[model samples]
Target: MTTKKETRTFNIENLNTRDGGEGESVIGGYAAVFNSPTEIGGGCFTEEIAPGAFSRAIAENSDIRALFNHDWNNVLGRTKSGTLQLSEDERGLKFEVTLPNTSLGRDLKESMQRGDINECSFGFIPTEEHWDYNVEPAKRMILEVDLFEISVVSIPAYEDTEASVIRSKEVNEQVEKRMNLIKKINTTLEAI
Candidate 1:
């Protein structure tokens, strides 16, 4: 199947670590939301990014990478190797990345510490979408997507989006895990 690449920006809701001294940092927030239409390319599109969107992809391949500014040339961390963790919550996909003690990862940690980087951009390929013309301008809703990479960026295009990192444990992690399981069960049952 053909996959269309897309990126969504979120304000840094939480940045778990700084100085790269701890070796791990958790980045959490909504990567995308349902019924929210934002201007994309030359038209307006509402991305669903439903709960089940990343289920199939994450199951089949968990080796997703974490890059700097979405640069393929720079490899900061990954998921399958246990360097990065990913999940889908009620708001959107959340991440817990184990930042390497390397120079690159350290730099990333510093930038986040200084608030120089407050937005995160995730790259994904759309798996399912629909067009709605009932509104003034034609719009599209991306029902599902396959995540590729998550990056730390400078500017974000969306509003009310957050991507900050914090030092304490977030209560939402457990909540997301439970929600994911529930969604998976519901999806499987729907198929039956």
Candidate 2:
């Protein structure tokens, strides 16, 4: 089975760019916040990342990249090269990307400093998740993930019509299936 990769973007208030000695620029921020609920698929469901979700992936030393707008061609940093550093702290997955001395990097740094870009995103494949169908719109707790990349983005693209519709359908199906199983269990108990 092919694993579907998902991307989540957050409006990070603390995302900042600073000089990294020798006039080099660095951008840093929390890519994913722990226990923060975010509405997904046009409010069809809510999703949140659980603490330690990236622990295993980080411990395994996954070669993740830091990109601009999730565009591979606009690569900024890589974990393997020491340009991208990732850590899971109490708040969430924090990252620091040493901006390259290139046109793309320089432009990104200027944009971030000007507050034109203050959002961060991460791409990952969910390894473990818990869904709560009892909730009104349903909730998904991402317990673990195989992280691939983090990006400093100007806009969030998760709400594109076609993608949202497809995800909403998948979430609704899961909720319905679980609800049926729950009803069957309750009925069996009442008959006992």
- For lDDT, the strongest prediction is 2
Tens digit per residue, CA lDDT, model 1, 85-163: 7776665666767676678777877787777877777887778766544443444566677788887776664222332
Question: Would you give me the overall lDDT of model 2?
Answer: 0.86
For model 1, the run of ten residues with the poorest summed lDDT: 163-172
After superposition, the stretches of candidate 1 with alpha carbons farther than 4 Å from their true spots are: 18-30, 33-35, 157-192
Regions of candidate 2 where Cα sits further than 4 Å from its true position: 159-164, 176-192
At residue 183, give the lDDT of candidate 1: 72
Candidate 2 per-residue lDDT over residues 1-192, each given as its tens digit = 116787889987478788999988998989999999998866767899999999999888558899998888999999999999999999999999999999999999888888888998888889999888767677889999999999888897652448756866886677767777877887999999
Model 1 has an lDDT value of: 0.62
Error of 2 at 146 (Å): 0.2
